[model samples]
Target: MINAFGALRPDQPIHVFTKASRWLLDRTITVPVTIVEQAVDSGAIQRDSLQLDVPATLASAAQFEAGADEAAVALAREFRARHVQVAVCDAPPMPCTAAHLAGVPAVVLANFTWDWIFEDFIAEHPAFAELPARLGVRYARADAAWRLPMHGGFGTVRTVLDFPWIARRSRRGRAELRRLIGAGDARPLVLISFGGYGVANMALAHHAGAPYRLVLSGGAEHSPTDAPPDALHLDRERLDALGLRYEDLVAAVDVVASKPGYGIVSECVANGAALLYTDRGRFREYPVMVDEMPQVLPCRHIANASLASDRWDEEVAGLLAQPRPEIRPLVNGADVAAGMISAML
Candidate 1:
């Protein structure tokens, strides 16, 4: 949403509705919603949190549904008060409900909607049987659903656009960031990131026996002795201090070790960084993203169990020995989506 709106013309005014979920904060490693709220508060964007209690986990569907309704009513009132005509969101159904209630056009921008994710659980747990249908009905109200690459295409919405990948461009040069991270010009830098929920045991990366510096994303607080003398934790604060964006770190690195997430995968592929990833348990997008590896860029699969063990050392060494090729996947997605939304106004 930040990137898209940044691409908008100067005349366009955009109001973003941010919300935080305590349920999500407890589960995620980074609590991204809080970061979004922080960004808004810091004047990075024109936005505010709805102050609603949104449930992030599927097990909390009952609470989520009730919360969504309350949030929808509050959000609709805000949209009307602001004279907003269009809305866009990635997951959860409340914003769609708000846009519909406020009689505004909504564009659902995501690799897969929440309903698509709920459908995967329905077969195993019957409690989610009605959820797919109910959520689908809410998402169907969108004017358009633009699906990003490496997505598990949605069954709920018929008009899904095969949207190009969206990634942040690198601001600082490679040498400068490497120097900031305290990595030597010769040694390779490997970044281990698993989104907001971090990997518990990264000490195993030390066993690779390669002369590489391992950088952990999200800053879980590590001792200098955690890995080798060279391993470091590159938290958001560290990146900010170096004037580097998250994507800048990803772009500057030799390899990115991450789970199969649309944002990370798309960024790695588009920016020409080697992707070494592991399975994300029960995530619907994992299968499609993993299957897309060989087709897009050089990638390797790291087992979940091996993440805590020293068994992945050989694979890590092999991946590090390979060359890094930059893959550019139409970086104009934000501009395109922004233009589409602008036309609606």
Candidate 2:
């Protein structure tokens, strides 16, 4: 447990993470996080590079795309025996519950949907109180010295955008984006995407028949092979670069249809893209993660999925016509995390 600890985000902005994790690594822990398609290995914890995932993540990605399955008692039993340890993992309702049942020493869940659903369960049980819409890493010493409700450590970083990357905008993304969005095919452009691939799929499906043309940003982890004929898929290979020089594809589009990851929100705000969000269950900070005042202006989320509704279109159009606000990105999450770490050490 001396090297470092990691409960990495499986479906998140890779560039943002590489940068954020480095801040701590350069100043504190030396070991780095190892992430593959869905599997992630944190710095040495219990064993060399101990994996912090709950039982479900090891079961293969297909069976539990939305969340982990609880029905399989055998799988759960085996996963718990191997994975049981002080760790942090974004366990939605079912899998997290399974991990708790299986007897993990400490669990830190990153996202929210299952957090809310299982809040009572975690809090009431005395084993899972650490997860309460809280971010950063959550854990206790082998003897339970640190407890739940801890916000962060080291340096506090609120908006993930502060960590720049070398990602570039694709040539296609550079084109003036125009899409039909509204009651008629003559409407303007409206794009939708979450920082991750799964959220992008939700946006495309939500506005399948809308008059607007949508552009979806895809990363190496995700692509446009199966995308609708009308949707434009853009490459994000440039994100791995060091300078963080990136294109403003969302800015050219009329309205953005996507989940607002903390970094994505700032990037969209930086680009001046009109945002129309579909809130994923637990990642509420996506919309509010920014400290910049203007970031709030262009961003918005629908209460439900209903593109055809006249009111929905009106709301979108109204925001599009309004003047945009200007604001700088916020930074605090990593600082808070660093401080927490100091206390823990």
Candidate 3:
């Protein structure tokens, strides 16, 4: 969403609505944002109190639905007062319903919708059975939906438009960032990205003698107590101090070792970096990305067992050995989406 915001016309007015607890909002976004109280919180994978329990979230569905109802009323009131012409969101159900309630046209931007994701969990936990259909009904209210690359099926949306990758480009050069991280040596720099909700019990220390130098974000809970000399754990403060953003480090690296998520995949494609991915649980979006991402960039999958055991040398070599795609997909979906939104206005 930030990428699309940056791509919009300088004179265009925009407002962002997100959850209050979203960590990325603080780290990446600069625009004034409105916190939506009833917003569905992201699931965390760490072994901490903050970890999002799927069963718990499903059990509280009624509470979330009631919150969404209140949020829609408030948002609709605000939209009418402001005379807002169009509403844009990243596949949130409340925003779509709110826009509909305000009699405003809504444009949904996403690779996958919450409805599709929730359906995957219904078999394991029956509490999620109704969520998919309910969310789908709301999502279908959108004026249009922009489907990005490595996308999943959007069965509920009425009008779906395909778009290229929307990604953040690296402002700093590779050599400059490598120097900043003290990775001057010829060894490959592998960025371990598991998103803000980090993985627990990751054996990062076991890769001490690997051919690559590992770089982990400080936000990740997967860091071992006894880290190797080759590993570099950088927090947001360190990144800011070194005059770099997370995307800059991603662009600088030879390969990003991660579970296939939209953010990391798009960034890798935009910056011409290889991907060494692993399974990210039962989320339906994982298979879609793993299958489709390789056609755009060099991508190789490592098993979850291999990742946990730090047996990544083979996968890393395979990913590096693969040649990049000759005809790369355009990374200008943000610009294209901005134009589409402008046209609506």
Better of 1 and 3 by lDDT: 3
**Tens-digit lDDT track of model 2 for 9-89:** 222211111223443334334344342222222211111111123322222222332233343244347445554333333
Q: What is the lDDT of candidate 2?
A: 0.38
Give the Cα lDDT of each candidate: 0.65, 0.38, 0.76
* Span of ten consecutive residues with least summed lDDT in model 2: 43-52
Q: Which pairs in model 3 have colliding backbones? A: none
Candidate 2: regions farther than 4 A off: 1-121, 130-187, 199-211, 218-230, 235-246, 283-295, 307-312, 326-345
Across 1-345, the per-residue lDDT of candidate 3 in tens digits comes to: 554654565455556665555766666766554544445323323323123356665656545665776778888888897777888878777778889999999878888887777777798898567777877888888988899987775788899999989998887888888889878788998887776545455555377788988887765465544557778877777888887888888888999988788988999999988998876666678788877887899999777777666567888898899988889999998788877777887
The top-ranked prediction according to TM-score is 3
Each candidate structure's TM-score, on Cα atoms with residue i matched to residue i, is 0.82, 0.42, 0.89
The true-versus-predicted C-alpha distance at residue 133 of model 2, in Å, is 14
> How many clashing pairs in candidate 2?
39
The best-first sequence of candidates by TM-score reads: 3, 1, 2
Ten contiguous residues with the weakest lDDT in model 1: 38-47
